[model samples]
Target: MEQIQEAYDALAIEFAASNPKSKAAYDIATKCLPGGNTRTVLFYEPFPLYTERAEGCHLWDVDGHKYVDLLGEYTAGLYGHSNPVILKAIQEALKRGLSFGSHHADEARLAQLIRDRFSGIELVRFTNSGTEATLMALAAAKIFTDRSKIMVFEGGYHGGGFLFKSGPHPVNVPHQFLMAQYNDTASVDELIAANGEDIAAIIVEPMIGSGGCIPGTPGFLAHLREKATEIGAVLIFDEVMTSRLYSGGGVQSELGITPDLTTLGKYIGGGMSFGAFGGKADIMSTYDPRATSTARKGASVPHAGTFNNNVLTMAAGSAGLENVFSPDVARTLHGRGDDLRNKLNSIAKGTILKVTGCGSIMNIRFIATPPEDIHNVRDLEGQSTLLLDMLHLYMLGQGFYMARRGFIALSLELTATELDGFLEAAQGFLRKYATLVSG
Candidate 1:
């Protein structure tokens, strides 16, 4: 049998040849954006395909090749591209005008809709991205509690600047972050015991999204809630990605554990660039502008973002939350994705490939043996990425588009038939690569 590397290189050659237009686009983009990509995750070996258009659950690359969009814009395209409701809302807002430098009712409308959907967000504020939302959430915690230490789990991803793989990224804010092992209650417990008095917040994702879509163990998450509360530290749940797991709330709602502050983004904006952070009024009140006296005394965390309450984002978000991704739609889509993941896992039962995730998001890992569990980045890192990347190229050839990192996020626009097609492609790939991937 050929070495996996050789087979993958041959596949890459075919991919590149078939994507001449994307190649040209990349050549042009490289002069502007580094490596022809602004988002590092989209960068893959050889080159990445450039998409020309997307509608519903499909995307057409610049080379005119079309594929099912299983990446779902990294879980932010929950409404799918060109969703009629979202389009209509944005169009209506555009007719009125774009960003209003001043406050508007649209902000109140969107905020109310969010509050109605999420019980934990008593008072909310908007930002341009999830990165900003989490940045502010931690800020609120620090000011509200007057502490600086933060407890974060390894492999946990809050935002671009807030990533903690093994330790803080080079560009990560200079916060005093205490690293704990994801899904290991003891790691968190030990940190809380030592830093309880100095810790201001315990921030975590309900599931590690960028770190490979690993879900948090219920016990570990519960321990965080209890310890953070006992320590008088703010517990912030970064639900920017997992909020799509359900409409009423996210993994927290499923697990019945509430955090003091919840940061949000992605689908909440109805496919627009948007984010939010809010929770118990007291913690959020740290940014209360009405407290002019507090601001004068330097006690209030005065917040300002020119487009924080952008009129267009508010209209689209309000419509998506209230009209498109209602509780019923969320439940139905999540059920469909769950069914798809189960089928894929069953087909991969005797092979190196394994799938893990919750609801509509999941990841694939190839290993020599089935892992006991994969609750942290280190566990995922131990797996073989060779077969995983092969799976990516093979599936792309089969008209399915998933993340290069083995991540899959389904869109509500996908019908059951399209989902079934995805399953067939996976089974076929397993059969074709039996010699390489089989145990």
Candidate 2:
């Protein structure tokens, strides 16, 4: 442990000195923000890299060092930074107006584009972030079903909301949120059997995000859909991170499964703050003003936000999705991801490391081979977080940028050459850090 700490300390000093602007900015941010950063997601071992700019799958740090941006803003930069189409859309919208707090054609146009692709969505509503989208979806489920309980996968992270926080809650209302093992049909069945008719919804990430980028087995997801239908519970897919995997939505296009509600974010905003939730027409109609008895001219679900459906976000999101949904782009990304996965697996063959997750969204588990069959969150206990932290910092020093949690998301702009470069860097890092990693 001491040796590992020393290695990290050395790297921290090197990182700080390597970029004077980032170091200074980090120091200043610490005074106003708790951890020298606004979002905890951006925090890294030595300190986060403060970027001067980014363009087409590359990031330049404040000190002007360039790197392949594998992190991709937690999988949100599917089109890469400053994409021409998205940037132009944003600029065009700026001339019109930023917000109106009223109806906008762009909002409905974007909504139609999403509805056309996602199997589960007949209607949709916008929110500022994935957190809000998931929250609203959960609330809608509870209200529509008149049930208090929600079932969530153990390793699934829907956001940092109180209801989804780690551990059991004592309050009656939020306490109804129960956890089951991810990708484990039996465990999920057991939970549903125990709670039965009381469960309003079963929420899961089609591919786990932050809990290690693990994908759900087909059988497990299928079972969840069946169970939800059997017990009259709404099945919700939180695809904020995995939506990039498919042109039409992740689970629906990839696995041929449909959910009652789907929450989306990440790339949809085109690097801006955005989120959305949508589902079957009947369920979504619960938010319709036409069905309400309120005296107001237009009212729905008691939902209103200052920035919801802002024109800039709508325009940029439409542009981003247009590029993302192209068949050629998807094929290119998946091909690169497959190459990266195969190469990493080969390099780690003799070592105690393993890689997992679906196309484009992957993770490197350290000190153990992730189960030959990883069906649930509990299966992840076999890996070592300490080793993961060491590996993350080591790779960072070698010019790779990924989450300490081992999440990696590829962008549309990264070419085959860049993919090979990243693999070469990983191979070199693993060879040098093998001794420390073995400990």
Model 2, CA-based lDDT: 0.78
Model 1: per-residue Cα lDDT at residue 294:
39
The 10-residue segment of model 2 with minimum total lDDT is 163-172
Candidate 2: residue 236 lDDT (0-100): 94
Return the TM-score for each candidate structure: 0.96, 0.92
Model 2, TM vs. native? 0.92
Candidate 2: regions farther than 4 A off? 162-175, 292-300
Which lDDT tens digits does candidate 1 get at residues 1-439? 3588888998899898889988888899999987788988898877888888898889999878899999998899888898998999999999998767888887898898877766577899999899999899999888888899999989878888888876899989889999999899988888887888999999999888988888888888898899888999999989998998965478777778989999999988888889999998878878887675332345577678888888888899998887888788888888887788888888888888888888899888886534347768777665777777788888889889999889988888999888889889998988987888877
Model 1's TM-score against the true structure? 0.96
Worst 10 residues of 1 by lDDT: 292-301
In the order shown, what is each candidate's alpha-carbon RMSD? 1.8, 2.9
